[model samples]
Target: MLIGEVARRSGVSTRMLRHYDSLGLVRPTGRTVGGYREYSEEDIRRIFHVESLRSLGLSLRQISRALADPAFAPASLVGDLIRRTEERLKREQELLDRLRAVDASAPFDWRGVLRIVELLHGLGSPDAARRQQTVLTPAEDAPVPAEVLAEAVLAEADPYVAGALRWALARAGADGVASLAAGVRSEHAEIRRRAVRALAELPGDEATAALADALGDSDPAVHRHAALALGARGTTTAVPTLVRMIVEGTNDVEAAEVLGTLAADPERTDRLMSALAAELAAPTADSAVRIRLAQALAEMPATSAHGLLRQLAHDEDRAVAAIASALVRAAEQRPQG
Candidate 1:
């Protein structure tokens, strides 16, 4: 067959085939007198085998070495890959555990308010501290009031004050949505994040929309919280934004969970299936995301995602592969009336 026909049949691009040939990976069986490459059935089998190995994460040099030896066992290669993958996952989990430990140790500190206010007021400068002393003192002989300096500190510490004020504002009315929305525009990112979470708890269309916009916040944790809040709303309108975040947002587990909710929409099942398939093929995708996608694919009716699930059943990621295999088995066992 021609290059186009081979690509169409094998799902491997023509350019990739040429590159493979250049590397002696899958050389064509014959060439026409006019110099056109012609591949045989054996060549197609070899190409599929190459794809299968590549999907299993074998490097070109490793693949070449394996192909050279007739005694090479694909199962043994898969075992090695699985061992390496587990080691990497173990390291990643260790790092995550350490970060969680650090976060847990440092609870919110109100003392930061004094430090930030002092820096903002230029109190670190010798002359500026002297000027503050003069301004703070009523007279050379008169004692300065502690209450006055405390009030000045509160005013200078705008971010901490704003957070406290917003919390207080939440109690101002039965509807916390409006007050939280106002705080979303606060100069402090932490305040905005808190406000977004607060608004998320309130039930309304306007509040949901505002929280959706908050998913684009500069802080990753804020964006993740926003996605979770929107997911909690569980409305159809939030689906589009959640779907967008699942596709383009950071590799956040919260966002992936939200995407799983959005995938429940019948109208989105096909698109979600396609995205899941692409994710299964992506080298850089998070394992958690891939597993979630596999689970999502498994939950759909047998007819909806059978082919994709079948492809994933052989994935190098054992967890995903097992899920896919179970899905495929369940699909096969379903009775046909």
Candidate 2:
């Protein structure tokens, strides 16, 4: 076939075919009477081979080496092409993410677009201080979007930076709560914990409800954090988890304090004491678990707690007995409320 026919059949432009000829990548094997280039069947086959290799992202130089060098191995070259393709895909995905974030911000002009881009760059900065500063300073009164802040909060490792991000997300309001809620169900324990903590800081019925829902998380740490936060917010659903925190000795002190706060209601006070007493008396309760329960009783007011401590003072476990006895005696000697 002639160059034009080859280009038309192969979907390659005539100009590109001529360029390939100049590079000696594919040269026609015959000539017309007018001295124009003429392609033989073998030459057309080689052109198709070059085009096939090019489809796999092979450079023209690499293709020349591949076609010319009989000793060339394709394994390493193909591996390199795979790696380069992956890198290009990654860059393109990042560009798409940036564009989405800018569009999500609903930028009013080029200035707003630039500001969102700059803020996003700062939020994703490797330096913790830069991330914190990005949250601290709004972009000319344009607050960072809640979804962006929620994403950062879930991945942030630096405690200080994470706190700043949480505070900013809270100020961003309920917009980020749904994103953080997804993090609560994450397979990663750390991410689940971070999500609950961020949700705790965000003010709204939605944030509180999300935290309350997390009370049943399979990860004890997650449910415990959620329980504590919800306890502070007066969510009655956290009561059982709070009691479990005491028994397991995970943040039991804070758990006891929140329980004490929650126990002020006469109805809740009765339930709190009943749960403590039952745990102390349960057949599965070990000495350590019983001791933790005894100690937790000390955090509540003497009116509701001292009665239980007195009964526990006579318990079988000597350590549990001693701790309960001490708490009771101290409660008695203190000034009356």
Candidate 3:
């Protein structure tokens, strides 16, 4: 086959085949009488081999080395190709994400788009200060999209930056609720915790509802955070979880404080006290758990907790008895409302 025929059959252009000849990557096995390039069957096979390697993202130089050196091992080269491909994919994915974020912003014009783009760059900056500034620097007149801030909140690893992101999301109000709600179901506990914390700061019935739903999260820490946030919002659904935290000794003090706030309501006083008392009564309630329960009970309205405190003052555990006794004495000396 001649060069033209070879190019036509192999799908490689004649110009490219001449360039391959110049590089000695593939040479014609023979020439026509007019001295035009002629390709033999064996030469055509080599051209197909080169094309096959190129399909795997191999550079012409590397392919040359591969075809020329029988001793060359493909393991190292293939590994490099894999790494390069992964890096390219990562860059492409990031670009796609940025584009999606921009599109989601639905900016009014080129200026708003530029601001969001610039803000995204700052958020993605490697420096923690820059990321925080990105969240803070956006003027109130042009708020960054809530979804963008929500995504940053989930991804931020730096404590200060995460806090700033959360503050910003809170101001975004219900706009971020959908993005954050999706995050609540993340398989990752860290992400779920972040999402919950952000939801906690937001001021709206929607944010409150999202936090309430997170009470059923499988991760103890996730549900615990959600419980604390819900308690502050006076969502009674958090009651059982708050009591469980006291029993489990996870953030028991804060849990008790929130419970105390909840207990201030006349109707809920008896119910909240009962929940704590029930935990104290549970067979699994260990000495430490009872002590936590006793401490939590003390945070309630003194009248509500006074009876339980009196009973616990003489309990079997010395530590529980001492603490409860002190609380009982204090309750006794308290002024009447």
Candidate 4:
């Protein structure tokens, strides 16, 4: 086959075939009387092989080495190709995401598009201060999309940056709730924890519902943050998690305060008091646990809590009795509401 016939059959252009020959990648096996390049069957097969390798993202140099160097191991080269392809895919996906975010923001002009692109880049910056500035600085002209903020809020690790991201998401409002909710279900424990904390800062029923759903998360930290948020929202579902937080002494003080808020509702007050009383009565409930429960009871104002406090005041455990007695005396001294 001649070069033209080879190009027509193998889908390799004549120009490329000549370039391949110049690089000594695939030289025609013979030439006709007119001195035109002629390709043998084996030469055409090598051309097809080079094309196939190029399709797999192999550079011309790599392909030449792969075809000619008997010592070149394919396994390592294939692994390298895989890694490079994956990196390229990651970059493309990030670009697609940025474009989608920009389009979703409905930028009015090139400047608007540039602003959002800048903000997105800033949010993903490795420098924590840069990420903070991305959230803190508000463009009166072009606002960053809420989805972008939500994504940052979920992935952020720096304490200060995370706080700023949460504030930005909250300011963005319900728009970021869906993203934050997805974060709540993330398999990563830290992500789930950060997600709920950010959700707690957001307003609206969506965020509240997400927090309520997070109350059942297996991570105690997740449950603590969700319960605190739900309790403040006056949701009864947070009662159990709030009580558990108190017993575990993890943010027990804030948990008790939120429980006190939840207890303001008459219907919920009994349930909250009963949960505390039951935990205190558990045989496995150690003295420290009992003392935390007694401290929590001081925050509850319901009549049921008063009765439980009275019972605890005379308990056999000296430390438990002392704390409970102090709570009761303090309650007695209060001018009855």
Instruction: Score each candidate by Cα lDDT.
Output: 0.62, 0.88, 0.89, 0.88
The candidate that achieves the highest lDDT relative to the unseen native structure:
3
Q: Model 3, 1-337: lDDT tens per residue?
A: 8988898899999999999999999999887899876898899999999999999999999999999999999999999999999999999998999999989988889888888888889989999988888788896555788888998898989999999998888777778888898999898999999999899888888888889879999989889999999999898999999998888888999999999999989989988988888887899988899888888987899978888888898899899999999988887888878
Q: Which residue pairs does candidate 4 place in steric collision?
A: none
What TM-score, computed on C-alpha atoms, does each candidate reach? 0.40, 0.89, 0.93, 0.93
Tens-digit lDDT track for model 1 on 96-119? 643443343342454543333332
Clashing pairs in 1: none
lDDT for model 3, please. Answer: 0.89
Per-residue lDDT for 35 in model 4? 89
Model 4 TM-score on a 0 to 1 scale: 0.93
lDDT of 2 by residue, 173-213 (tens): 88999889899888898999999999988888988888987
How much is 271 displaced in model 3, in angstroms? Answer: 2.3
Q: Give the per-residue lDDT of model 4 (tens digit) for 129-173.
A: 888987899688988889888888788889999998888777877
**Model 1 lDDT at residue 104:** 33
Determine which window of 10 residues in candidate 4 has minimal summed lDDT. Answer: 297-306
**Can you give the lDDT of residue 220 in candidate 4?**
84
In terms of TM-score, the best-performing candidate is: 4
Report per-prediction Cα RMSD to one decimal. Answer: 30.4, 2.5, 1.9, 1.8
lDDT of 2: 0.88
